[model samples]
Target: MPQPAPAVQRSGGPIAPHLRRLLEFVEPGREDVCLDVARGRGPMPAALAPQVRHVTAVDAMPEPPARADTSGRMSTIEFGTGPVRITGDGGPDGDRPAAATTREDRVRHPIGPDRPTIKADATALPYRDNAFSLVTARFSLYTLGDPDDVLRELLRVCRPDGRVIIADLVRGNLAGPERDRIERLRDPDHPGTPSIARLTEMITSAGGSIRRLDVFTVERPIEPWLAGACDDAAADRIREALLDEVDGGPKTGAKPRVIGGELWFTQTWAHVAAEPIP
Candidate 1:
């Protein structure tokens, strides 16, 4: 049995550059109510909180053990229309003082307060129809067994004129199956990574009209990528496979290559934005 994927170590840190890129497709609005599915310990809620009216983050995974706060003092800020308060140590921006007068004030101080996060299943979301203007899931599809059901639920909760955004790592047409095999070796719970075409089909089949589709390649070092794997033996196997591929062995579909004496590989990420066809 494969061990669970390791918890994200950069939780609560500044928003990642890759996540920032994904947000471009989301285009959150000030009046929009957003729902982020399978939101792990990501900074999506905090990143979207200031830009949107409200953001509800849901995940099936139980909350991880809290890390000790090095900064002793705690502060609070008002979030959204409701009294959802964000509390954290060391001011809003880690060093700056908290401001509460206007939206501009909130935008300038993006790093304060923990937003609301609910533990829930994605296929069976606990929300009413047409509840949110923007529904999003990032890097979640490969973990789910029934992505089609999850997509339908996303569309079910989105307003008619609203957008449903999905982003995940994809496999190349020829290399996809082999890539998925390696991914499973690293994390047994991983269901396979879908090709871009397959993902688009799933969305369209689930009552979504594609508005925009973007595909980009991200290069990652093998060590950092394997750092999230909980199984040491599995991680070693993946490393060996990539190294073997580099030495002209069977292709692992990871497109592994050595860069300045370190092993590296590439991943294709696809971002799709769709609207519910009402």
Candidate 2:
């Protein structure tokens, strides 16, 4: 039987340069009311919670060990972490199963009530227009079914002067064909990463004025990476691609290496902040 993919816990781990770039771009203020869309474990909530007046974290699904009730709403439980709301998004019935972070580059789960995490869809946000001072999506934008609509929603909930922040993987690390193959093997839901140009175009087209753009790399270990695969075949192909590029190196773009006696690869991410145009 194909082994279940592994969950790469990144929040409680070491910080990567790309994540650092995001922190710099976010620059949450003391009086700012921020909204973090697709709140995973809670990286944005954890970091921005301290920076802003409040951080409303929202995601479609809850995390592991916590299942949704029949009514189809988030159920938060009292625990060691204050309120542990297990979040994930499988489907409407809420049984699809959340995709484990193949590359747990971003931070892990959100921490406290000051950074309240809620389960909701991005396209149909429940906030009024110009509701938040800042809206952000880290590493989760491109994975959505309707990335453009989500972008619009992000802009919608944001105040006219508010900023919409996006820090995500640019589809350039691996060769086009190879990356597609590996991703299909890894997670069927993996909507290939978008290029930096395409992302900017989307933002600007939505009437957002680009404010800040930063690009950086994040290195990921292969052993834990494979755990995100849906099947053994995908795991094998991805491993082989990295191994094939290990000695001579990858001509496509993805650079694979061995560190601490494990195979690894580097991913390029972009941090873009845009404000609603006047």
* Best candidate (score: TM-score): 1
Model 1 Cα displacement at 152 (Å)? Answer: 0.8
Superposed by TM-score, candidate 2 places the C-alpha of residue 7 at a distance from the truth, in angstroms, of: 27
Worst 10 residues of 2 by lDDT: 77-86
Q: Candidate 1 regions off by >4 Å? A: 1-14, 62-115
The runs of at least 3 residues in candidate 2 whose Cα sits more than 4 Å from the true structure, single-residue gaps closed, are 1-18, 61-116, 172-175, 249-252
> In lDDT terms, which candidate is top?
1
lDDT of 1 by residue, 144-164 (tens): 337888899999999998988
Query: How well is each residue in 167-256 modelled by candidate 2, as lDDT tens digits?
Result: 776764333666555656778877776776788899888778777776655566665656667888878878887787786756535567
| Per-model CA lDDT versus the true structure | 0.67, 0.63
